[model samples]
Target: MGPRKITAHGDKGAEVQGKIRRLGSWRRAAAMIVAVGTVWAGTVMPASADTDLPEYLTKMRAPEMWKVADGTGITVAVIDSGVKDLPELEGRVLPGVSFMEPPVSRPEEKYPVHDDFEGHGTSMIAAIVGDGSGGGPHGLAPGAKVMPIRTSIGSPMAFGAIGEAGKGVRYAADNGAKIINLSIGGWWSLDRIGPAIEYAQSKGVLVFVGMGNDGSKMSNPIAALPGAFGVGAVDINGEPLESSSNGSATDFAAFGGKVPIRCKKNTAWCMQDGGTSYATSLASASAALVWSAHPDWTANQVARVLLQTAGGPVDGAKRNDWVGYGIARPSKVLIDRQGDPGAPDTDPLASPTPQPSTPSADPAAAVPPQAESTAAESDRSWKWPALGAAVAVILGLGITGILKRRRR
Candidate 1:
């Protein structure tokens, strides 16, 4: 059957549609994950779609934040279908690797590491670093560079997709990528991808992963993996998008509802889309802004400040499953300079004691004794239970089926 259109409406009077690809299972482990590549393509009816900036940017106060730091000298690796160059991404997209099989039977022009077959990778890149030239979607960190790493995740080759994605993660860590974005979701075994995630963490690279679009049914297991920050999606009203998966693993939330994305069927126009995929990108870009401004800080330090400055839990808890610490607000760090950098080697989400890693040489990298105690008490109080819950979900559940995008 041919692809069907899915029209969705949002507060901005913007509408979008695209073909949907249902989730497929991998028999080896009876595992399946929601693919972030679904693009609901159809007619867009916004009155001024061409000239308007995404509402999230305005909400984020992106212009004011950019004046402080634009993610200069930071590189984010996007692992997905691949990234096609867009005018908004000129001179910023880096040469990246791909793990998909060679299209030997078809014309070589039809496939390349940057082909962007699903337009998923390109949208992600644009969300992080697009320059907004010619009315394209402007990224949160326009000065950042994107390292494209293409891999097949939702195709007939589903069985090997995780392995390919693992290699991409490792490559990103080894190649100086400060941040890695994995927007794919599913309930695959940790044995397949855990090592690479750990490797990235060990290399001091922050990995931002999507919580999936499964809503309350489940979050992506990958987000539950240790050392990975699971990101959920929130609407402009600071409420969780009904489609964004949530659980103990959700570490953060971002503006994902009706997010401006490069159109899959047409590159000339932008479409409003929603998912944890775009939320993850925005979270990663927020990290870039912090990292670029404090280039001397270790990954742990950058993460610490973000956690400290994020919009705190609405319920006044240290952290919650729905929105993690809270919606990521880099402005707190960039504009107000409110968050404490903490110890260079200590993980804010983990114990307060210094991790067994090299300490920062910067004179200002030391943590205050009081700060360490406070953070330790607060994090231990909340993080361990959530971690246990996430681990349990990973081993106990065997969910499968279509992960449809939610429309309001």
Candidate 2:
């Protein structure tokens, strides 16, 4: 995640800051945004007579690679907060659905969609496929279309949140979305969402998830879910940010810090937005670019190529804890023609086969009589602390916003 200081409105600032502090170390894990006037290192593009690319784009060589693949004919599903009708995303976003209603709902009313309440989803959508009109930052996959699915106004942590996320995944898969970008996550299990993830995988949909901003820990549940590609954040210099979460589940890293984002209210752009959320969007767009160029390739093949060609340290490690396979280098696959698109049907994750869990016929066979005393002892001491942390982060943080005007 990017470095940001939370500034609540008016008198609520102290209360919000106090609550944020109660989250303990998790406060540092919250998704971050750049303050309005901050300038990150290696992000100042030279002024030119012609339009100059955003620093992150130029560093990633997006323009040079655009000639090879621009994510044409691809649809990326952004399942987060609602996506607004931002000028940059005017024609690229498709009509989507909302899962924010109560569990028991009557069929009389229509749920709202395509209206971003917190402005997080719109920023994410812009990162994936904004057309860069009005001198806005160009998305990695400007030619790709986006399907905006509203799961929550802020974080996707409402009641039955997992079920809503599962439903969103299914909807995207059914609607011909090639890539599903989940920029929000929590510390929940995958049990509720497993079937939906399987459904997407079966439909050849590549699902990319944010690895969270919790450094050095694999805390977020979505990152551990099989078939979900966990993305981490890196700086313009291709180094993993210290705040970026790290674990075995982290699949790849992409430029997240100092990336340009559309502002929440005005038409101006912000250059300081960052976190695994933005990185996930870029990775999703990269997948779209590869898949669009190789129309014949299956999701598995595209995923394989991305992993194979990703750039990393000279040590030659297959995967690192912070960056996984390493920073996503779509240029290597698209322009350099590196990496082989392996077998289409074979799963790149290669998850282990599940074994049946048939129980014994005996009534008392599951537990030993001697361990009954210990089994009844409940040690839930961590719940209250963890819940407090979760609440603080869920209420305060989100995808970082964009800033600044393009230089010419």
Candidate 3:
């Protein structure tokens, strides 16, 4: 969660402001920010340098977290570039599938899940439930499993791939994956995206998707449907990331700020790396911890607990558009002995946005600005409201997420 400090955007008690201050009642009502222009102490910061979370390596509250989520027994499907299997992750990660096609194959590395050009996915998996075998990253839920589902490929802007990323979403849900983490994005789709999201929610899987880093362009799909939780990125200081993206699509902003990432597949000692992708992975792992602790709870209840207990100012309780329910404080859930898991049959979100129109394929479909010049509202909108998992052989999305076809 970003600092619950004061801000210039809205009132003091505004949901955003309250989150800045938090429950303990900050010393002064003053909202503070770091030199870099992002959210700091509840205020819009001025542009500055890298904003990573501060190092506070505390002892594991529940050392047993590893026993539950080695990511071996429970499957956590990661839909992104690919897993390159590093030394620390040896024997931990599943063999996994790739969407990179034949010519471009999974990176040739040793460990278990150490593949990726972006390095975001690897870092996230580590945070959620790192093996910690060789003193590697230990995940919040160590006893869980890891599921890798590769979707879409390419570099920065001009990236393109199979149009059907939805397939991956479905596959994850259909499979037995309990958690889905999506760190990727594209334009919104009511037709292609909506129904698939509904499927995941129905399956009782928790989906944690990143609200794009392009706050000025796209919209967030945190919980595309109710019950789902969207996650935003924050720095080590508990503030928002300059490029982490924001708006209503966010349900829970996370620690996406600047942090040193370990080396990728071949080498170690990574220099520069961090993004909402990694944060989402951490959020997914955090969810795993909550789920592991309360195995019987449905995805909705787990999600609600995380949001309800998330650190925030009691004065402003409404969910925000950009930062959604606020920062995800799984620690709160771990300590809340009396927390309710919520009803199993009911949905979390009050209303799911109607599906968006698709292209020429469907008879009732509208042209839709699929090629529109505008960026996705979830990504660029100033406010956001919303939420992922993976599948197996078919390589669907994380929660019963979007299931796109693998390219030939």
In order, the Cα lDDT scores of the candidates are 0.65, 0.62, 0.47
For each of the candidates, give the backbone clash count.
6, 6, 108
- Lowest lDDT 10-mer window, candidate 3? 27-36
Q: Model 1: per-residue lDDT, tens digit, 1-408?
A: 321121111221111111111221222112224364334553453434444666678777788898989999999999887887777789889999887654346535334677775577888888899876666677899899999988764344443455578888899999999999988754443455667887788899999988776455245666656568888877776766666666556677787777556564435445655578888999999999999999999988888877776664443455555566677888878887877788887766664422221223311111111111111111100011233234423552432122111111
Q: Give the TM-scores of the predictions, in the order they appear.
A: 0.75, 0.72, 0.63
Tens-digit lDDT string for candidate 2 (62-109) = 887789888889999988767777667887888888875543445464
- Per-residue error for 250 in candidate 2, Å, reads 0.7
Using lDDT as the measure, the top candidate is 1
**Which ranges of candidate 3 are over 4 A from the true structure?**
1-73, 101-118, 133-136, 155-164, 188-190, 215-217, 221-228, 262-266, 271-273, 313-315, 351-408
| Alpha carbon deviation, residue 241, candidate 3 (Å) | 2.5
Q: Roughly what TM-score does model 2 have, to 2 decimal places? A: 0.72
Candidate 3's TM-score reads: 0.63
Descending-lDDT candidate ranking: 1, 2, 3
- Candidate 3 shows a clash count of 108
> What is the C-alpha local distance difference test score of candidate 3?
0.47
